[model samples]
Target chain A: MSGRTDTINELVRTPPTSFVDSLARARVRDRLVDGVAASVGDLPSGALVEVTLASIRRARSHPEALGQSEEPFAWKPVFVRRSLGLAAVRSCAEGRFALPSAAVGPVADQAVEEWERTGQRTFHWEPWFAGLGVGGRAVVLAEAAAWATSLWAAFDWTTLNSQVRIGGMDDLWTCPAPRTVRLKGRSEVRTRLDMVVDGRRIAGSDGGPSALVSVSGGVPSEGWREDLAYLALVAGLRAPDRPVPARVVGLWPDAAEERTVEIDEAALDGAVDRVVATVAMTAAAARSTSDDRPGCTSDSGTLVGSAAA
Target chain B: MAGPVAGPVAGPVAGHVAGPGTSGSTPWSASWQPLAGAALLERLRVTGRPRPAADPVLSSDLRSFLESGLCEVLVEAAGSGLVVTQGRLTRALTCRAHRMDDQSAEHEFTIPLATSALIDVLFRQLVTTGSIDDPMADALDGLSLDAHRAPLVDWMHGLAQAERRELRSEVERQADGLRQRWPALDPSWLPRTQTPLRAVLAGGQIDLSVYVDLVIGRPAADVASVAFVDVRSGARRPGHRDDRHLGALVEALRAPAPPFAVATYYTKTGELDVDPVDSDLLVAAARRCLAGIRAMDSLGRGEEPEGTGSESCTMCAMGLSGEPTPATASIGAISNVAEAILHVAEARVVAPSTQTYAQGQAA
Candidate 1:
């Protein structure tokens, strides 16, 4: 626990101010975007996390496995519960309402209802919800409500502007590049920082500094700061116009604790390096599989290698 | 928070069903009727016409099963990207000439994006309070005033004095109309605006997603108690009734039993058209959705699905010849469509960023 805490503390330390900071940040963002674009070239669009996890798994087990089909990711009740809990907390935060455990059920119900209404089968949680008995569903909803209550209690909702606090699954940041390379950034809560400009309190524009708040579970894990940095990087790349996120705050409800990662040149560079490596690995894995296919063409190999280069 | 209260009264109204489906019973049925799963399969058989022989293989086993009634040969195509939305489904069903083309245009999205953001803000406010005092001001305040919405806001602010005056007056009128017509919804109803609805069909091989404008009622309520509301700005167009029915179908499929009803409200005309959720509505809506999925599957297979020439073709940008000039074009519609298009584009741009950022660090 002490070692993990130190790692988390070191990751959250204040960043240095330097003249080349902006340039460094820009370079990192561009490299990350280009790397992601290269690896994701014309591949099926998926969340960054999904692609990374899949790539890592593929790399470890049978990296040469040919003709493998992507397996459907099954979403469990815990995912839905977490998502619903976040939504409940967000609604309360943005609407300036008191947190209530009862509010969680409706939010969960609405999520299910929305999933059904939209016919988006990609949600993956529908089957889980459908499989639950009435009592089982109630328990899930209760747990979600409790989770939301804990989160709401942990934050000072009034300090944040109710109107500006973007929450839920809505604020997904996406960067689509040539050859169908697509990357997405998902945050549970994002809000613009108010800057004092010329003696006037003005809300930052999308291009201006902003804070990203993510809700997670358990103790701070390895690469947690890099994750936040990557989110900031992707968010910046997607907008290009918007300023890189000022800071990212990770909230762990179970522990009733939080870790803040300030976005800086070093953070951006770290994120870029990690993403480039992941994308290269994914591209290599994809290439290996494609090479073993029945009608494999040399052209496909060239494309993958050149893109990853 | 308060415990669940008694459900709202269900009743029927007289009007053409808005998006798709047959007109029959009242808006709210006295009893809940579940949409049988088999009924959807039957509807697909009736609606999903076969495409050309040269069409590519329908990729997923689930899709092929839905189309050909054969569950075998579910080949999961490696890395296929397919996103089916309500608008795309509506277009697939209503348009005669369908060609999949990139319709990305910078200018095409200006008006609609602004309108949607404005409307979304007002609705969000409405969910908090039963009524809106000043729609324009309230909406402006609610906007994050970010880069994406800045142009829309600027355009809004750049209006001529007279135009601004007219806009404000219109906003006030619409807001008042919405307030008067809107039922005294309990805060406990947990009304949400711009709620996303997604589901996996055919064993997670096909994904369908859409966003409902406003939804009220608890999921824990009786299956027949939840209600879905769609807000529109213009006079209802042809096949618009089917859209509402689609909303009903979505709710019915997701609910413990079936939803109570679904309604479409026209802010411009102050018209509210309601349709009871029934097996018939679900079947009809499912047919359209299935037909859409089939069309999408065909498109995915490098085959052009036949389009049923209709009013939707006017808005189709697939470069089909001899298309009629859009008859339903209006300032409101233009803005709405623009906003919807840009909203979709923005989401695409943002989704990947968020996912990557969070996932990258987690890794």
Candidate 2:
């Protein structure tokens, strides 16, 4: 009475149902699964090695390298030199060096005692005698002097506070160094800069109404203020209200005040029009380069005197 | 779904239902009338409702089950009484002893997974010991307590733990034997939650804190009331035991804070309180916690197991718990499991300059 007989014969097919399609389809599906699993098993060894190497690199092997190194000078400028024979310039302006640490009373305590005797707010000196194990203090002292020259290119008299010695200490050997000084055994480097300030507008030594804005960039590219918009505003040659297509850096010294926005040379016709539309400008002037050698790589400029002041 | 013949319909009236004379109904025709209508109604009835366990099983032979798949009479039986219920799947703890979270727990705390093998192997240990727990700690505790049986104890213990996770050891053992036989068979299982540090730092995953808010259930209240009245005390009000204290706990459980992890800091001596979270909030918290773990993974990122030179590393399980030493961030110390073992790694984050670092303290 039931219709199970035909359906049962159809349901329990082994090799072929009607010998044409079902057998062929079953073979295709089984083959596909085998192929997928087999391919999954064959992952390459090169990819494994890449992952292993990457993990190792991420852990970091080196102890001394801080952040990233950028361009020609890989390290931060620890010392700035103006003329020569000055104290060192240090990039770490806010921190104090720890004492050699083996000392019984700790270096800070001993330095505080020395500061009490000296009666000054700041102190600048290195060890005269290499009585301690620090025999190579001279190497540190020399670098500090080089830094002093560069930093003091803008300032003549760097302060010396005896009381706030290197991290609250005053002993030449045991003490901390002053926050803003490069010291070599009580000697300080002083370099003079000539600045002309009329009310607020600062002029250069050559009687030009220009302010030296020193822009120091650090390695791995981050310490140079990342905001290009802010930088364009300060550079004054270009106002960044829109995308101007090309990046520009303007450097001028002892030149007439740029009354007009200067354009770069060899521009296609639409380039000047784009600059006028994008950058804050008076009438556009013919593009000129700043000095080629010592001061700048730009040729003939009455358009820029940028910072590094 | 084979159909009627594709040839022309040149016979009776095209719209009429089937009748006896034109098709020449056999003697079984009258019987099939009610049966056919009944079959149609039966299919319609069974659409949403289950088949009432009247669905045939081993009792049905090929002739009996016209639609059910069977060649010879089926052997396996699933009778009408085979209905499984929710209570069978779920379990609850008989011992209501609360677990001690790290901060509130006693210093130098020791936990003995109490009772005979019945309790230790079968019950509390089920909740406490697993790959989810510290395997090394579990192994050490097992060895110390039942080291005499040695190989036998370990075998039994492994079996019990495997059963706890509802995985049969025989399956793994069979796989192991197969792998041994087939030298090229490489079987590796990775945790679902753990992605590499690069992926986490690059925001490869959708940020956990954002989507985790879609936890199961309605949103909870923000303000929490923590009442400290004990009805058991003579001086305390009895009504507070049920009304206020539990009321607060139930509310807190349902509606935890926005920042899922909040330290309940006591003002007097800088102590902390861990509040109970609602079931839904807990689930949401669990997923969001993965992000914090992802963050920790990035900060320590490819961190070496060696001393971070911080005093906090003292409590690090990845570091030797008893003694601090330089070592490879020993074999997957940065894994999610390691983060759980070193719960303090998530709990306490102290930020100080190199000078004020706790490790810099006088030895």
Candidate 3:
């Protein structure tokens, strides 16, 4: 329990309550804003995804350079299992389908039936399903059942408002900047928390408080907090109206624990700074790779090098 | 599951009568065309003008006929308590007329389940936000994911990089087309999508259900004011008229007042076919529903209805035995794989959440 509390505390600071304390909180928010803006302000617009990809590529290319061991180069495929599992959870929450545990056999059958019928083959698992042996197919279904069961057991879904829309997989927000640079945010579950007035539930708005749920394995050692922050930033920027996410929850189902990051003005600032730093690293790596190319002319190379610098 | 009960024939029963025209080839301009929203309601008002109370003996005879003929089918279909939905009823009626075998019946069931899932997701997004920013991405987003072994996930994982890219591109194109052609529904009309309507029959032994894709106007409003819209994935089928009629039935059963209109929108063709709801239409729909229940009862009793000898009968599973159609092939491949998965899941059955079940009961 202490470990879980520590995890949550790492991301969200206690809110100031008193009038005098509120001013102190505002000052903290302003300082964070200034710091974050300065970091990401210089990058060309619409480069967030490019920069994020570049950072991963760079990390892959020179693991030793970042004090890490190197691994063979392979495309890190998108996790379809996580997406499907989240969807099942959402469907259950929305009462569209009975939870997997109620009838695992039927639930799994229907899920696969839907995937096939819909002609969805974009997932990395598509090929795996095609080549799967009988035993492999069984294993896949077993895993689906287990995953769905775990999600079903995790929360008290009945307490949530009946009108609350449970969205899974497809929540994406994009904010375009100068130079065609854009920042995108993806959340596994974007639950628009319902407002209760006199014990009656009302629909949530774009500006209303939302809880962004991200599914992952165990907490990562590097940039984990920033990762959540980055997600918050994208959600804030992409929000069609006012009031971005009030909090982000990262669920590690394997560990059966979750980390919550409260989004204050300061948190937003921190997220932007992290994005800017990642973009800068990507830009630097791109420049170095071009400089090392044999076909590059020295005069033109310097210009490229100077621009990167 | 007894054989159909033999009884004296009553005067011109409901389902036996010829329904309004549903032929896709015939031009709609040939006769009375479907009326749009407000106009349809106005027509209903005129046609449904209150009449003198009917003879008590006649009303009693009609009720008895409905109970014995229709209730028997519903009770049999709900054997051990199965939910009977509008879709299921529609299938029973269509299959009975076509004399479809068990295989064809199952295939028909699979098609709509799949299509409805896709349409439901899209409709949810539209009603929630009033627009879709990225159709392809949104559709993909609706899929559930997990990190462990899941057939769909595994299949997605196994896709070659190029193949994955190609799939995404195609999805984007289709999504874009859907978004561009999506009807401009006013959000203020209180548009709601995938709304579930349920009514129990045969003393709650059978649950007759229907899900309207997009419903405009509020629940408390006059029934004639609310518009019930059904979204179809492909071009309008001859059976679509039955589906619209079912919509009318759903409205009549659930809402205090009959709906203003019932319509179907074909996603591919971007055509909306609106039918006005009148007392006569409701009666017709009620008769069709009773016929469907009766058919289900016959099937339970191992009695197959005679085929109508329509051209559509050519596609029935009874006559077709050679190479599988594309739909059949795809469904077979997928269902086989899904059946395998279900076998494993069944072996490791987990206890369902009591709270969730209780919540469902509450709903």
Model 3 Cα lDDT, one tens digit per residue, B236-315: 56567667777766555544445545767655444556554554555555555665655455556776533212222223
User: What are the per-residue Cα lDDT tens digits for candidate 2 across A160-276?
Assistant: 111111111111211011111100111121111123346442212221111112212111111122122122222221212321212211111001001111111222122222221
Overall lDDT per candidate, in order of appearance: 0.49, 0.20, 0.45
DockQ of 1: 0.03
> What's the CA error at residue A32 for candidate 2, in Å?
7.4
TM-score value, chain A, candidate 3 = 0.62
Kindly indicate the candidate among 1 and 2 with the higher DockQ.
1
For each candidate, the DockQ is 0.03, 0.01, 0.02
**TM-score of structure candidate 2:** 0.14
Sort candidate 1 into its docking category: incorrect
All candidates in order of TM-score, best leading: 1, 3, 2
Q: Write the number of the candidate with greater TM-score, choosing between 2 and 3.
A: 3
- Poorest 10 consecutive residues of model 1 chain B by lDDT? B47-56
Scored against the true structure, residue B312 in model 1 reaches a CA lDDT of: 41
Per-residue error for A85 in candidate 2, Å, reads 88
On TM-score, the candidate that comes out on top is: 1
Ranking the candidates on DockQ from highest down gives 1, 3, 2
